[model samples]
Target: METLGEGDGPIDIHDYRHGLKLLKETRETSLWTNKKGYACPACGKPFEQLFTSEKQHNTFSPSSVTPFCIRREADRVLMFRH
Candidate 1:
């Protein structure tokens, strides 16, 4: 959402939500690449959990798939993938 690039820092909730919405609408397998990292807009927490490779991304079923660098949490705002 923030024009995917390095040195862009973390994305905000509006961007993250927009990305997820696009992903769902397009039924995309993954959100860009894990080449860079992202942060949770609401909490400002970096998304440390990432898929090491594209194969790993493909292995996940659609229902269980989430953003490449995002981590699922108990907070409702952080659960954008759902």
Candidate 2:
């Protein structure tokens, strides 16, 4: 058997409707960080995702998490992962 991710998706640190699990309810600000880092498909270098919020204090790991990419546009949203 293959080893699945710890969360729903490899990159699913937060839910658009239900919100985030790794972040605190009282803590304000959207930020994503991975110490191990993820390889960028375009640059081939490690990168992290940081959501802009009122403040800047948040972090998470991608070690066993799923790998996904979300892109939102004026018309629609796009998601892709291996």
Candidate 3:
């Protein structure tokens, strides 16, 4: 794995690898969202929320859900109805 950031970025190689390992080994049921994004446990790769849908909220299993964070660009912040 490669280091994701140089100075003070959210991701690093270690965290990214750890996150990938955790994703494969663990079955997380709840989805966690944050504004600053999350660093992968093994390798430091930033994971962000790319998309969300309220209609599919209860339809999918928790194990299949991938927790992500939101990164605000400029002054625009995107929000979804839950």
> Per-residue lDDT of 1-82 in model 3, one digit per residue for the tens?
3322434444322443433322111131223233344443324565442222223222545654665333322332222112
Candidate scoring better on TM-score of 2 and 3: 2
Best by TM-score: 2
lDDT of 2: 0.35
Compared with the true structure, all predictions reach lDDT values of 0.34, 0.35, 0.33
Candidate 3 regions exceeding 4 Å error are 1-28, 49-82
Indicate the residue-level lDDT of 11 in model 3.
32
Q: Using lDDT as the measure, which candidate wins?
A: 2
Higher-lDDT candidate among 1 and 3?
1
Q: How many backbone clashes does candidate 2 have?
A: 4
Q: Rank the models by lDDT, top first.
A: 2, 1, 3
lDDT of 1 by residue, 19-77 (tens): 33222222323343222344444344444332222232334577656553343322211
How high is each candidate's TM-score?
0.23, 0.27, 0.24
Which lDDT tens digits does candidate 2 get at residues 1-82?
1111223333333323232222323344344443344443333444444333333232335752456554333333322232
